[model samples]
Target: VAARSPEPVTPSLSFPQRREKIERRQQEVENELKMWDPHNDPNAQGDAFKTLFVARVNYDTTESKLRREFEVYGPIKRIYMVYSKRSGKPRGYAFIEYEHERDMHSAYKHADGKKIDGRRVLVDVERGRTVKGWRPRRLGGGLGGTRRGGADVNIRHSGRDDTSRYDER
Candidate 1:
């Protein structure tokens, strides 16, 4: 009887194939890291803060006053003071847009917690668009309910009463 020869075993992956797979995995990890990087994040971009939200603004604060205060940091593109439609007065908040992000950042860093018109104001980067259909909430529950300052009366007499309270005197 002739001795049987063993067959050679094949490797699951060639050296080149393993190297390519490793490179691909490394690239995927790099891409994921880049996505999480603050510098690469869209919201962290240099122009992300070109617009700023200034809160606690004096109701009488004017756009010109805001421009003057912020202009020291950079050129002002626009200034918008939120106003109440009923009273037609400033709503205690405003948005300021700067010509450059550098100025906006400067203003945000320096003006935050600073006094404007004798009131401390908050400066922050404007985030996203304002929500639509949002309404100001009433101090207490909504109007017209007994819980909200509405009067509650209990009638002492029924309609079928024979007392004739409405009879002519």
Candidate 2:
């Protein structure tokens, strides 16, 4: 007799359910981040002092476009855009490496809040390897972006056009 395999199950979540799920995941990451030690990681890449971590990138944004946008600050060494290994699609974020740390600093300060491909990308120095007790947004410890809807959502991570509060006359 031949046995049939069970079908895979996929659950569609409501808005609040998705929010709850995100909260739980964030909490788990928070706990894990507390014990993380970047020094022990053997697979670390890039020069932290000269690299800038950019997030909220548009998937359609290309490396050349990114380069052209960032080249204003200084000479760039590389642009490493993150992509999904399973799907091979852009992951909406990237790391831009500059030839000098001073260039990185300038970009880190001015590149943030600039629109790229119609999305305002968030820029921060590569603090994962340089700063102590630093946790990435995936680990729920970064200064920008969160699924939790609260008062602070508009505080540190306020750069997108939708969140801007310019006076309308």
Deviating ranges (above 4 Å) for candidate 2? 1-44, 144-169
Model 1: CA > 4 A from native = 1-48, 129-169
Q: Tell me which residue pairs clash in candidate 2.
A: none
Residues 1-169 of candidate 1: C-alpha lDDT, one tens digit per residue: 9988888888699899999998987787666544443334443323435788788898877888888888999898887778788988778988788898777767876898888899999776554322222112221111122122213443312211123221211
Provide the TM-score for each candidate, comma-separated. 0.48, 0.63
Model 2 lDDT tens row, 1-169: 8999888888799899999999998788877876777767643466777888888999999999999999999999999898898999999989899998888878976888899989999887666776555566577556564434566554534232233221111
**Each model's total of backbone clashes:** 0, 0
Residue-pair clashes, model 1: 0
- What is the Å distance of residue 143 in model 2 from its true position? 1.7
lDDT of every predicted structure (CA atoms): 0.63, 0.77
Clashing residue pairs, candidate 1? none
